[model samples]
Target: MSHPVKLYVYDLSNGIAKQMSLQLTGRQIDGIWHTSIVVYGREIFYGQGLTETVPGRSHHGSPVQIVDLGTTDIDQDTFNEYLAEIKEHYTAEKYHLLDFNCNSFTNDCAGFLTGGSIPEYIKDLPTDFLSTPFGAALRPTIDAMFRRPTPGTTPAQVPTPTPVSTQPMPNPELVGSILQAVAAQAQRTGQPAASTPQATTSLTSPLHPCANSASFKSLLKTHRAVVACFSNVVTCPPCRVIAPIFEDLAHKKGLKSGGGAGAVFTKIDLATPSGQALGSEWGVRVMPTFMFFLDGHKIAEMKGADANELRTQIDLLLYQAYPPHKHTSLSLPAMQSLSLKPILFSQVPNLDAVANKLLSSITSVNNSERVKQIITGSVVPYLKSRSSTKALPTVLVAWTEVTSTLSSSLPPESLFPLVDMWRLALLDPAVATWCAANFSSSPLVTLSRVASKLSIQQCPRPYALTLLRLLSNAFSSNVLAPRFFIGNFRLEVIALVIPSLLHGDGSVRNSGASLAFNMAAFLQTGRAEAVRNSNGGGTVKSDMEDEEWEIEMVSAVVEAIDREKTSEDVVHRLVASIGCLLRLSPFYDTQVSSLLEVLQAKQILKAKLQPGQCGEKGVEKKEVRKLLEEVANKLCA
Candidate 1:
């Protein structure tokens, strides 16, 4: 049955915004709007993460306006499933007052349920506010207000809307204990854990506030590069002048390097007693003094407030901290332009045929009958109707049971159809998330096991191809991908993929190339983020693991490129994988560079770039040749 969906709009300013906006911004905004979706006897909004409350009983009190958003035929079970899938994207740490706030979440939910959008006026509040001169001036203030708390700030100080849940929430401390136990067990056994996903703090705001001496010390200890500005904002005019410039530089550099791992910008006001003591300890008497710190020691300082000088020094610090890879200087536009998106095999096969094949492969009468029912009763219907509605949690639970039974009993060669079916279902983010979170029984574990059982040289073509595609599709889940990179899982993946790269079967090689590309893309993205956050340079083992994985993949890819005499498509994918592995890589100067030299990777690639040597002559071949040349240049230069 269809249910009514309404938008609950509240004025955060309590009707005062309309009265004062004209005077404050010289442009009248009707309200400082906060919105929520009211459906299924609950009011849902994004604040301190996704929250639900009894209608009209939220902390916002009663909404000023309720807009009829039309009705949705989506059932409560389906909607709840949808909520679980979307919750990860809407964490409290990810909320931004001017960007992704309450209105944005409502609009997303509205579209999902009703295939419509919230009113433009309500959605456009941030844009409208920022366009105004006064509103533009308030951007930094809005950012700082919503930013995650820096060190030394109590959790109570961070603004969070208290959620009134329909049911009692789980004990947070108990949940933490469970997660710690799981992680510990996983570490002891060298297995990947199904630990609860933690919300990562968003680093949207580059400037981290140093509240006192303790916070300042903590910041220096944690961050590799920090730019500390010591000044009294209330008393120092020059401090005010250079403040914006410093902030702007932080944002720019933070963006370039990726936040968190990059340089951290902080300000200490000498007007406060704590700030006064900090300044004394740093021996700063000037009205505005800029100190550059690397490895927790002050390396450079400037007494005057010079914008150009500040920019220059900050650039130098970043350069010294994160030296550009030699490949970055090469003219390799084709390699540079390679898209880092995961290469996915998403084509849907005949579901009935696949189900029949799976049923025929099962030997146990009871298990066979149960699997058949799941295919017809839950899995098939869910896959068909997933576009318009969500499957109940039980649908996935049933599939999980069926997967465990078959994956354990079925022979390695007989598992292709089952793996193929799982691959199709995993395209749904909901299923992917469930699989990612349920580590032990995850079909991904089954896929990995099946790959391990099959000899890389003698595996059936269909089974090998399906396994490769299944691994590729696993990257669909943001949650699963990261987990896959941890513990022994990463090594298992390397073991499966390296041999497949040089498989005698051309189709298996193609599938293997696609999987390799996906793996490389994942690493490249993480490396880029680390560089942006200034986390790439340290002796962190996670960084080392990533470097090791890349070096192994690159070695296999270069050999694959040399052996590949046909299929421009495979060549393109293989070269693209090499590019991603090398680009923005921290170990390019040492491990990766030395490996490339030993392999004579540049010469092998240049030989492939020669006309008629790599693949059949066509537009695709020309593209492959171009990529090969670029990769060759990046390798040698």
Candidate 2:
């Protein structure tokens, strides 16, 4: 059931939306009214930088035409969360009419909804107006009253900012009472009593917060190391802004969370009486202050909400308390005992013929960095064109010969030029597509296996990672998909390919994900090809056996998703693969079905992509959500 997302646009200039446009550029300007998103006939609106909520009659008194933004599979709660994140950033304090406004918010929501921006003309209205000389001259007059209008109330009645408490607070009695109350609560809650810090426990979480001087003393005594955050939750906005960041670093690091001997985190709210006393005791007046302590003595203090300074100071404390684990870096023993196996093929009838020709005539190495030229120079032109089936077999056989003749005494670096050339060939989509049809056979398997051998856990060599990624890239073309289920081929492919999903190297895991997507592409194209043939295309493609591809490849993809569950990149690719597989599956594979629920249960749905992560290639957040929704609705419903 698809829900059409309608944007209920209103021009704020009463009926002068056309006049406002005339004052600016010739863009289609919806009269300057506020806007809201109506989904399922519910008008969802935002105001004064608040989260999306059902609006009263004040907004959208007379709305413009409702835009049918296609449809979305996003549920209300998830959509609301996206709105909340927007509200957090586009707060009343931050909303600028010329910069960020309701239209900007609507544009963001529309982008999330349909993977398209709201009509460009509406989005550019403010900018269009501001750019003109007449509009520019009147901007100050117009901007003052319009940006953040209180829908139901006037500006005078808007909540006033709370003043920071500056009165000298040396309330020892109150501080002692607060400490006793916390201590009593801890006892009743069965929290660990104040005791000496133990190496095994990591002395509570670095984000374990304290409210007053007494709690701070208790934590300082118990943990022996502390990073106290002096923030104001009541009056200071930046203090509130930096509060979560202060805790997030601790949570991500987990040093103070019983992972190792790490620094303990404590919070002091200047708004409270004990907090006020503590602030005065520390000789601090400003909000969002940070002070580092060891053994109940302060060694460093930061006076502002500077993220860099906070991180640096916290890192300094963590370094002092819980130094880096010895095994974080690659060690000598792990490298010396590296046990790498080369991936192999099940059937190669013409191997000897190809190997004999390759062994007898080796291509000379060139000084240039162009790898495709080098490999092509070594082999025939048929391989590069990808027009003939004979090209794949010859290439595989030729590659296998190179690996077989190599001595164990030879260092992996000795084959750098050869690997570089291979990597380059795989870089080409034509070559990659042609190569993927070979599926789980010798050349691809051997290449991956050899790359795996070089991948020592916690000691990933750049070359090994690069080769694996290239092999993964090679499989990305559509040539392999239409032929994945011809006979016993799919099973053989899975047997050769699946273990790499669990490779300890994150880059290798990412590569395995790429390969899964490639296979998924094959699955989708294969299904479409089937539909095409069924619908009277005379191209009668061969035996796509029932339940075989789904049983083997779906299981392979599910296991791959499980193996790299922690990796968002891997999971993103795996989820896409599984979604395709489910559509392709005659009976939606149970393992794949359950996996979606597992991901949701584990909060993998809530997990955010890192900076610069805009999903895999062109697929963005909207697509990801749709894939998730398809699984959830079908399986759970």
TM-score between model 2 and native: 0.31
User: Which lDDT tens digits does candidate 1 get at residues 348-456?
Assistant: 8888887778778776745687788887788877766665244456877788788778777877677788788778877776666566546656777766876776665
lDDT per residue as tens, model 2, 1-637? 6678888776555554464342122233556546677775566554455434453343335565666677878787777655554454444444444434566566656656665556656655554554332233333333332234445744432121121121111122332343233222212212333332111111222344343344455456545468888877778998888877876766544331101245656676676554676788788878888889877888899888899888888777756654432222222231122211112111212323433433333334232223333244444344334343535556655554554444122344454334444554554444454354334443454544454454423223544554544454444333323233433445444543465566766766666666656665544444434333222111112233345555566566655654444556566666666655554333434343564455452233223233322334322456555554443344322
Extract clashing residue pairs from model 2: 10-33, 11-31, 11-32, 11-33, 12-32, 12-33, 17-31, 340-453, 481-522
lDDT for model 1 = 0.69
Quick one: RMSD of model 2?
27.0
For every candidate, C-alpha RMSD to the true structure in Å: 19.0, 27.0
* Candidate 2: residue 391 Cα off by (Å): 13
Q: List the global CA lDDT of all models.
A: 0.69, 0.48
Whose lDDT is greatest here?
1
